[model samples]
Structures are given as C-alpha cells and as structure tokens.
Target: MNNKQQIEKMTDMMSKFIALVSYKLPDDVENKLKELSDEETNPLAKTIYNTMEENQNLAQELKRPSCQDTGVLQFFIKCGQNFPLIGQLEKILRDSVYQSTLDTPLRHNSVETFDEYNTGKNIGKGTPSIFWEIEEESDKVEIYTYMAGGGCSLPGAATVLMPGEGYETVVKFVLDRMTSYGINACPPLLVGVGVGTSVETAALNSKLALMRSVESKSENENAAKMEKLLEDGINAIGLGPQGLKGAKSVMGVNVVNTARHPSTIGVAVNTGCWSHRRGKITFDSDLNYEINTHKGVKL
Candidate 1:
C-alpha cells in the first residue's frame, strides 16, 4: 500500500481497537476483579461483583459498550525514533478517534468549554488528548489507549506540599481524597499516585500509573513499599464493591515518583473505576501489531 493507504488502514485498525477496548476489560483487570469477587465475603459486595461480570459478558456478547459513559479518549504514545509511520502518527490517531466515535457510537462526551455546547462527535478543540514520548534506537511504537470516564476522572487532584511534610503527607492526601470522594468514582478503584517536583508532572505520572497492570510493582524499593502500604491502608477503609462497605476499598495502589525540588513535594491522585477500560497496543516498523493488554482478541 502507498503511504496514504497505509495511514487509512492503520487508522481503521486503531478505530476498531478503540471500540474493542470500550467493550472489553483488559485481561489483568478482568482477572483482578474475578479474584476480588471470589474473595469477597459481604453478600452485597458479592452480588455487585457478580453483576459486573454479567455486564462484561453482555457487553461483549452484544457488541456494545460496557458503560453508558464511553468516556473521553486519551492516547499515551511511546514512539520509536526510527518508526516508519512516525510522521503520520498524530493524524492517524486523530482520525481514529473520529472514526471510533461513529463506529463505536461512543457517548458524546466532549463539550466546548465556555460555549457550553456538546461536540456530539467526541472531537472538538483539544478533545481526545494525546501525550507522546519518543524512544531512542527502537523500531516499534507503543500506544496506551484509556477511557477517562466522568465519575472516575472527577476525583483527580494535585498539589505542592511543604518539603517538611514528607511522604507521610502524600499518603494522607490520597487517603483524604479516597475517604471523601472516592465513592463517587465507584469503589474497588485502582488508585494511581504520582510524586514529582510540580503538580502537572505529578498529575501526568499518576494517570500513567493507572495504565499499569494491577499486579505490577515499582522498581524503586521505597515506592514498592509505599504501594503495599497504601493498598493495605485503603483496603482497610472497607469501601468494598460499589462503596457499600466490604473487605477492600481498592483493587490496587500504584505509585510513580520522580526527583522533586528540594523545597516542594508534588503529589497527585487518579482513580480508575472497576470497569477500567484501557488497552496497550504496539506496532513494529512493518506495521505488524500486537495487543498486550487484551488477549485472544483481534482488531
């Protein structure tokens, strides 16, 4: 195929992939939910988990979205410097979002700010946000597609803390948010915590954390320990399934940290609700593709 045809084909593939992710939970998330359901003792929590499983099955079987709020699409891209389609990547992704809106019939979630008008197509000024990271000496591109649903994204927060406050403050911040507003996002959340020198950087890191597998751990020993501690502390809250109170408040806790300014500690929180619609796909120079987050599925 010529370059034009290649771009069209890739865009179509991505559109289908987006639709696929909207309906199907990633493998890791599905497994985690199953484990939680089996381990849950509360009758209400058990019923809720069972219903969630039913929802997943029906969505797939009927070829429909799992949730009514199809969410705002976000793409986190890691592109290799030598990838053949590097030049066309941005346009391809934008086109894919537009096509997915029509093909998947995604909920009209994007609205024009200040103007107070819905875009209807899920595409508007700066809608369908894309973030990029260029990798060195590689020939493959990895893209993380996430659906940031309204309720879950509402709890996102970031702030700069006094250096003296320390990591303890970070823990307190997350706990406060979870206790106060987490239920609005739905319970058994996968909490992503980001620590950096500034609020924006930390916020981005927190969102990135949500894309990680629920079973994954940070490389840094301290961060890994914090993850475990936070997970334990949150689960102690007993928010359970649908926040009706149960054995666990969260599915997992993930921490992503970076070197911070000596005077400030920036921390942020992002939560992914139980449905957690996200997927990872990679493409080589030849445009050969692999789906890492979902298995036994074709785009």
Candidate 2:
C-alpha cells in the first residue's frame, strides 16, 4: 500500500483498538482485580468487586465504554528508528485520536487552557499527549494507549526532596498523598511511583510506572523492595475497594526509577482507578501487530 493507504489502515486499526480499550481492562488489571476480589473478606468490599466485574462484563457484551469519563488519551510510544512509518507516526496517532473520539464516542474531556472552551473533538493544543522513546537498531514500534480519567489523574503529584531526606521520605510522600487524596481516585487503585533526577522526569516516570503489569517487579533490587513496602503500606491504609474499607487499599504499587543527581531526590505519584483502561500494541516493520496487554482479542 502507498503511504496514504498505510496511514489510513493504521489509523483505522488504532481507532478500533482505542474503542476496545475503553470497554475492556487489560489482562493484568482484570486478573489482579479478580485476585483481589477473591482475597477480600468484607461483604461490602466483595459486593463492590462483584459490581466491578459486572460492569466489565456488561461493557464488553454491549460494546460500550466501562466508565463514563474516558478521561484524556495519552500515547507512550517506543518507536524503532528503522520503522517504516516513523515519519508518519505522530500524524497517525493524532488522526487515530480524532477518529477514536468519534468512533468510540470518548467523553469530550479536552478543554483549551485559559480559554476555558471544550475542544469537542478531544484534540487540542496538547490533548492526547504523546511521549516517545526511540529504540536503536529495531524494526518494531510499541505503543501504549492510556485513558487517564479525571478522578485518578487528579491525584498525580511530583516534588523534589532534599538530598538528606532519603528514600524513606519518598515513601512518606507517596503515603501522604495516597491517604489524603487517593480515595478520590476510586479504590483498589494501581499506584505508580517514579523517582528520577527532577520533577518533570519523575512525573513522566510515574505515569510510565502505571503502564507496567501489576505483577511485574522493578528490576532494581532496592526499587523492587520499595514497591513491596509501599504496596503493603498502602494496603494497610484500609482504603479497600472503592475506598469503603476492605482487605486491601490498592491493587499494586509499581516503582519506576532512574539514577538521580546527588543533590535531589525527585519523586512523583500517579494512580489508576479500578478500571484501569490501557493497552499495548506493537507493530513490526511490515506493520503486523500484536496486542500484549490484552489477549484473545484482535483489532
């Protein structure tokens, strides 16, 4: 196919994939929720889990969005330097967002800053925010599509801590935020904690952390240990499912970190609510695709 045809095909596939993501939770998330539900002992918490499961089922059966607030769309792309569509990748993603807005009927969540006007199309100055990572000597592009609802997105925070404060302070910062505002994001949340050299980097890493599988542990030994401690500490808070009090406060705590400057310890927190709507799609040089986050499904 010509470039125009290739772009059109990819766009169409992405539009449908976005719509699918809206209605279906990724396999890791769905499985985690199920495990949590089975482990929960409280009657009310169990009921809430049941309702959540029902919601998922109904959304898929009816081909409708699981949550009313689809939030803002964000794409985290790891593009191969040699990927054929590298030049057109940005335009393709933008077009996919526009097409998905209409086809998936995503909630109009993009609003112009200062102007206070809705974009209606979910495309504005920076709507459908895209983050890219270019891979060397590769021929496959991996794209992560995430829908960050307002409730969950609202709890995101980043800060630079004094060097002396140490990693203990990082734990304290995350705990403080989770206890104070995590309830607003809906319970059984998947928490993403990022540690880097600065606020911006930390913030971005925090969001990236959210995209990791709930079952995956950080490669860094210290970071992995921190993930366990934070997960236990957060669950100890008793936020439970829907924050109504249950056996666990969160689905998981994921930490993504990078070496930081000696002068500062930057940390950030991002949460994904019960219905964490995100998916991963990878395309080869030939444009063949594989959906990693969701299985037994085709776009």
TM-score of each: 0.98, 0.99
lDDT of 2 by residue, 1-299 (tens): 88888889898988999999999999999999999999999999999999999999999999889999998999999999999999999888888988989988889999999999998988889778999999999989999999999999988999999999999999999999999999999989999999999999999999999999988999999999999999999999999888999999888899999889999999999999999999999999878899999998998
Give me the displacement of residue 101 in model 1, in angstroms: 1.0
Residue range 116-201, candidate 1, lDDT tens digits? 99988888888789999999999899999999999999889999999999999999999999988899888789999999999998
Minimum summed lDDT over a 10-residue window in model 2 is located at 119-128
Would you list the clashing residue pairs of candidate 2? none
Please report how far candidate 1 places residue 258 from its true position, in Å: 1.4
Estimate candidate 2's alpha-carbon lDDT, on a 0 to 1 scale.
0.93
User: How many clashes show up in model 1?
Assistant: 0
TM-score of decoy 1: 0.98
Candidate 1 stretches with Cα past 4 Å from truth are none
* Pairs in clash, predicted candidate 1: none
